[model samples]
Target: MYLYYSFIRVFKYLCRERERRGQTMYLRSAARGFLAFLLLVSALHGYHDWTVTYTSSTVCALRGSTVEVSCSYEYPDKLQNRSTPVETLWFTKEDHSQPGGLVSDTDYAGRVERSCEEHSCSLSSCSGNCTLRIRDLRQSDSAEYKVRFITNQPGGEYTGDPGVKLTVTDLKVKVPHWIRLWKYLECQSMCVLSDHPNYVWYKNGQHAEREITKMFYIKEGDSVSCAVEGSERFHSPLVCAKGIKNLCNKVTYSTRTMCVLQGTSVDISCTYSTYRGLKLKEKYWYAWSNNNEPTDLQKDSEYKGRVQYPVKERGGSTLKITDLRDTDSAEYRFKYKSKSHEWKSALHGTTLTVTGLRVEGAAVAPVTEGQRVTLSCSTRCLLPGQTSYIWYHNKGPVAEPESTMNKLVLDPVGLQHAGSYSCSVRGYPHQSPEETLTVSCIMCILCRD
Candidate 1:
């Protein structure tokens, strides 16, 4: 704020000077160009100095445990170089400046080095990754961290000068701590919602920079990797998401975390842009079935006993299930609803390909509360990058304009998600039978006595 105010004063002074000499044409033109150049330089400076991105800023950690802050960077081509290695300093802005505060100053001297392999200004190392470990973390460590990188720009270089801040909070961890007690755990992770100043994640052993939910599950022998770099799954092949963690460079500080299950509790999460999410009031977690009806698992008994929405800071929705079984498999989904009544859906579906089950499963009825479930049946699909996908469920018509694919994810499937799902490709002019879809699924019991 101090620098911002100082810059504003200088900017105003410069403008006043230009106005004072407006009568001089030559002076006016020169001043205008000078101002423009300054503005561009300012933007560039802010771009590098102001950025403190994380692969996965907020990490979900168990209470009375440790959590790491994965902070990374992306600088302009000119400003970032290997010889003049950019020094990343992690500390509390004002609280503790005694050369230390949350993360030890000397701790990351060697391990938290920069990576020149990918992004010239990337942060990574061999000992592990660019993760900041917080030991004996208190409930307060659940706040954003002011992560800054200090580097000098040549005196005449057209570089930028800005400060970078990344959040480092320990959002509540999903699933019981006992689950990871005694397993090599090649897969599976819980949600950790937080508004850290800067946050990032290193799954397996690489920088999870993209913010989308890239499921680690792959086809047989497809080489499901434990390294964060190996996660290639993007579209849920079920429901699309709004805040699905994409590991991309985003302007908003808020984020989402999605978990994929092979045969158990499925947790779907979404985080919004940072500042706008401060006073979180309502975060509606929605789902659909094969029929495309909206369903709220929060109130439904099917989820009432097991589902848990742990975000109390800036409201968020969480769907948790226990007693992992084949029958509990289904296309689980969710979306975000804010205070202004604005709505955006990142709903997704997960087809539980039940391999081992006794009785033929049936569609679970949306018990008497008369709730709503959203069945995504559109031909429009958009990926993290460019190019979109189409969605379809049951025999619904969701294409008017050109759509990517004829795929739809049935969320919160009650009796509707139970219907025979199919989708007709878009741009085919007529709903051709060749482009139709038929969802093949098996059912089972959710809980055992």
Candidate 2:
């Protein structure tokens, strides 16, 4: 490849020289070109000792997606009984003169990945194939890529003369015509580099599914589009044909309300659906209070290390919250995304109410008639304004007006108040566990006896 490029450069220079002068200048330029070609051929012959062959000399990838450059290398074997260690690297620069040739540009710091598998390894030497995968590609990432390997043996470092060329392009939804007879709309990428990328399909601005093909049933008045799976972050613009509006599928939640004991964990569950061909790209939990915009709980400092969302089937997901607190009580919702959709929350959200359970008074108390007794039920934090307190006696509601308050008062203790007592906030599914209350009868002796 380098020889071809060099030849082009030399030919261009010779043509320019010919256009400038007569046969004398033309002859001189032709000689120089011949010398350059000879030098290139000599260099190529020497580099044949350690040759590398790439799967493809050029790759065209979509921006914001991933691309893999693969290559296999061949090298001469070292002396028998001597072991040599081998290291492989992929880079865009040819700076093997320095100790470090794999020094990547800052733009690709964490996005570049390399993997190697040794096809043959013996006491004398080793040979293998290497693949370089780059994620989140950008337009600026288009460049020439090379593979090089170093060995402990003397003069064992070799870099391929010509590298693979990458061309990064943005995705566009091309809709030439709808197949009315087939009842499907053919949506295609302007250009796709990967052979078998998962396609993210969208309709009217909402996600549909991870489509197996770039074709969909046309909905009258609905806009449709498609994008590469990982490139959903940089989705293609929506393309509509007949109608501008139509139904779009979305995610859904299981329950709208939940109550949990403080210090315990709770699972907030939901089931979601999207277009049949679209794939889920990401999912997370977010919360909002008092009409505020929802905030991602994963990024929230308070929820750090205490929150987890377990992976479920394509249609199901769950968020588990540990060490619940009163402050953690809020309207929580599940959010998910496919390649073409941004963060989307469920239409119905789940509300969480974390409460502490405690009985203020003793469970067993011996009291005589005419003695005042009091039993209180309270939570760690004041309940919401609409929350109501309900007192219970022996598993039944206490028929007292003041039972709504935190304290339940028996102005004059009697046997009727001797049964088990407990309290719970109205609207809460559970009440405090029952506590026993014992009452003693008062007796008087007659002096005449």
- The per-prediction tally of clashing pairs is 67, 11
Report the C-alpha lDDT of model 1 over 165-281, residue by residue, as the tens digit. 333332311221222222121223333333421222233222333432333321111111221222221211111112223221111112222222223455554443322233435
The local lDDT score (0 to 100) that residue 71 gets in candidate 2 is: 92
How well does model 2 score by local distance difference test? 0.68
Q: How close is candidate 2 to the true structure, as a TM-score?
A: 0.40
Q: Which sections of candidate 2 miss by over 4 Å?
A: 1-48, 95-103, 117-125, 152-154, 177-186, 196-200, 205-221, 228-235, 241-449
lDDT of 2 by residue, 1-449 (tens): 67667877877777777768655666676778678878878787555757789999889887756789999987766544566567887777544564233434555644567888865755534568999888767788888988778876568788875899998886556665567722354445444456777777776545776765555666554455566666554455555454323323444456545666677788888765554435777777888554666666878899999988776666778888888888998878777667876544323367777887666675354776677887767664434334456888888887873333467888798777888887776655567877788777776313333
Candidate 1 — which residues are off by over 4 angstroms? 1-50, 55-60, 76-82, 93-129, 135-140, 152-449
lDDT of all the models against the reference? 0.37, 0.68
TM value for model 1: 0.23
